[model samples]
Target: MVYQRARDQAELSAIQEAYHLVSKRMEGVPGLLGNELLRSAHDPSGLVVMSRWSDLAAFQAWEQGSEHRADTAPLRPYQDTRMEIPFGVYEVDAAY
Candidate 1:
């Protein structure tokens, strides 16, 4: 079970919009396992995503797909206010 985490900030409304897009559209895409959007209780502007894919390739394909691009278009306007500060990603090794 490999996971990818993307940390970004957006208005509650935009987060809601993006959330729907992923739930509806991403599920149909190949290689998607599941994903969720998490908001910081301390900071509304802080948004974190926990996504699982069949594997890294599947995740990369989704990232490069048009569905991801188009769905995220709505987030452009608020880039300044609702953007992640600096994020890090770590790999999870495969289990035996």
Candidate 2:
């Protein structure tokens, strides 16, 4: 997942909406999983986005996929991002 910053409330909301809708399109991909978005309590402009995929390849494929490209419709109108940072990637080693 990654954390991105927006310039203001409007931009932050747009990013959140975009991410939410985009994930739905990613549902059937191989190794597909789920994700979450968080706004910093201290700074609401800070967004934390975490996405889980079947694997790195799956994630990469999604990034390069055409469907993923189309999902940008919600964000194209708003150039609302300030900065983005990769928080971390966790591998599913063991789970129930």
Per-model lDDT? 0.57, 0.68
Task: For candidate 2, list the clashing residue pairs, or say none.
Answer: 31-54
TM-score of 1: 0.60
How far is 90's C-alpha from truth in model 2 (Å)?
A: 6.5
Off by over 4 Å in 1: 1-10, 75-89, 94-96
Candidate 2: tens digits of C-alpha lDDT, residues 9-52? 77777787887776776667666677777778998666766777
How many clashing residue pairs appear in each of the predictions shown? Answer: 1, 1
TM-scores for candidates 1 onward, in order:
0.60, 0.61
- List candidate 2 segments past 4 Å from native: 72-96
